[model samples]
Target: MTSSSRRVVVAINPAASFGLGSEVGPALVTTLRGLGHEVTSLTEPDFAQLLDATRAALREKPDALVVGGGDGMVNLGVTALEGTRIPLGIVPSGTGNDMARGLSIPIGDTEAAITALTAALHRPPRVIDAGRIAFDGGRARFACILAAGFDALVNERANRMRWPRGRSRYTIALLIELARLRPIEYRLTLDGVEHVERALLVAVANNLSFGGGMKVAPDASLDDGLFDVVLVRPLGRLAFLRIYPRVFAGTHVTDSRVVVHRAREVRIEAAGVVAYADGERIAPLPVDIHMQEGSLRVLA
Candidate 1:
């Protein structure tokens, strides 16, 4: 599509980022319209409803679909647009905006992001990798990251907290969970290697960060066509306390107790483990994950 004919659709999650979606939606739409592009704003919808909206938007053949919520919303929108030529745009307004941060998209200023989106619309779309998770009956999806074990527990707690939002809430939740957290035994087949461990957390990442800003897989690249597997081995509370802070700076991988590896696919099985994909609980035990290389086109 030509730049002048470009149409932009913004999917807003009013409940995301402590309810900033309502406040940000109109402003973003106004800005984009002022730039001479057609714009549409959509309120938060369930996954199926959201998919329908995306598919309808695709029929219109918009130049870009600007995702205006957090990581989960972004994942939903991207899942609908995957394998198509539609270039995805993002305006980070969610609790963890980790995917936006990874792509260097602006977070705070709506006007600046509008400008960036407008410019990005004129450029060629870049293809990136997305992660997929499968279970017995069906499959779940993720665009940025996924985690199993303690980190998933932290996510559950953070979702329940009411006071703080974004990274602050995540930190508080982590501290709360750490006091009583226990490691779990799991058997995993990564790429072709098999091993078992009592793991505190096992993170499989397509992008580098998750849980607001924690660098779960520091060396992970979106276009690398591989998943970065991060295993946090069982450690004492004191040791975990000392190591947790380093994840923020992307230096936790240097620790001897932490194990990081690259693989095209991973198979995980646990007795009573819950798994999370992009912060949403999808399944429990016996999960399979694989990387989809250059499957998503983003306006980055």
Candidate 2:
């Protein structure tokens, strides 16, 4: 085989975007194999099985590991290739392709995204910081934001619901969570300095966006050994509605109620709050996060 060709393993999520982009996985594998790379394609019945398959594939030491799906698939890749030198490649086929968006990867345009991936494979992979969360049960790695407040509650509720599928489920869950919104009293320790505060949401971000392009931390740096920790202070329902829309455009940071903190290590403590990283639930509050500088190699 030519030196330019790579031995690649592609893991795909069939439920990506609720099957809207089911064609992406097959296309990616075919394209890579056509480009003279040896491709091992893995498509499992569920997320857990797919993760297992991907981990097993990684044991063979592929040149690159590519994931076809949204941010959750990216989370799977993060854990599978953790502490390895192998680069992670992404095909944005999932609901929240925030990780791809943060890296300037083409979104919703399958051909363009594939072209970008192929080109990146030839060049050196980009190195970025990765966040590791250590909880009681286990530790998980993430390439994007960690939600430990109102946003995470919505994600938790939505994941538990079985009916009314697609993005609408998230909408319904948001309404439910919004109705139950209240300020959380948090004891945060950032780089060993402790502070107690009340906030509606606390997002610790390694990259820019989460929850479908909501730029909660627009100034987040990928290579820096720091987290752009965002805190949305307590607000009434009407005020929250006004600020919520601004987050999509990242204008929320301009408001007096929103605050951003940079920290390399963060200990988040809020009673009864579950944290979500890269769209996957990590654990309840009291999770410790460490920003590992240049810990992730990505084909972007």
Candidate 3:
């Protein structure tokens, strides 16, 4: 069947991008229906409600599930759609639609994204790897990158801020966290081999970028079946700040302070460090992350 005649369920986070969902959600429904596809548009009160609604929608067996939000919405969609055959569609309308950016989905332009997604859905869904995280009691899956140590701290702080809206909130939160940067004691076991170090940041990447297009792992590939584990060793405040700009251009991978490794399964443990992936907090450190090859099917 052609994509235009298929059934689609669009789940939107009303709070995404601080409120973009309120408009984007209705637009998606209208667009999808206008294309002659049957669309179910959902706007939930919160993340849990969104997840539950999307999960329920999946049981109806729609041709695809399109998310109209950011990376966090994609992460939630992945958690609900993983191991299933339905293709995931993205409309980037959030603070950091890095997953959309990494997947080459048009960012910030909802019409362009919808056009791209509609075209992509006409073909086979592109298979991509996803990171499965296992912690003390529970587990979760992330579609983009998993971050620990200093980056996670920044995410924690950014999520707590009320003033200074938009990206400036994150910048302020990053500065606040940067002022207190310190080496974290890390014990990492990658593919059964153990290594310990004092690192400032550790990122396990499936796609190439995160945090609104910061190319923390420039050489990462979503279908490679391996993770690009980028580690930044402890650096003084001035040097660390100097390397910050390089991350936006993804040049930090070549720096002397950065180390890159490839592994299928990794066990990470860092004292007092939390883990954040796709702009959502997963859990504290001591989580085992593994690359699940071809686990995600993206319409992009």
lDDT of 1 at 179: 91
Kindly list the per-residue Cα lDDT of model 3 for residues 84-198, writing each as its tens digit: 9898999988878889888888887888888898888688999898989999889999989999978898878888899887789888988998899899999999999999988
* Candidate 1 overall lDDT versus native: 0.82
Give lDDT per model, in order.
0.82, 0.92, 0.88
- Of the two candidates 1 and 2, the one with more favorable TM-score, higher being better, is 2
Error of 1 at 283 (Å): 1.7
Measured with C-alpha atoms, the lDDT of residue 269 in candidate 2 is: 96
Clashing pairs in 3: none
Q: Which consecutive 10 residues in model 3 have the weakest lDDT in total?
A: 14-23
The runs of at least 3 residues in candidate 2 whose Cα sits more than 4 Å from the true structure, single-residue gaps closed, are: 16-18
Shift of residue 258 alpha carbon in model 3, Å: 0.3
Better candidate by lDDT, 2 or 3: 2
Candidate ordering by lDDT (highest first):
2, 3, 1
Give the backbone clash total of model 1.
0
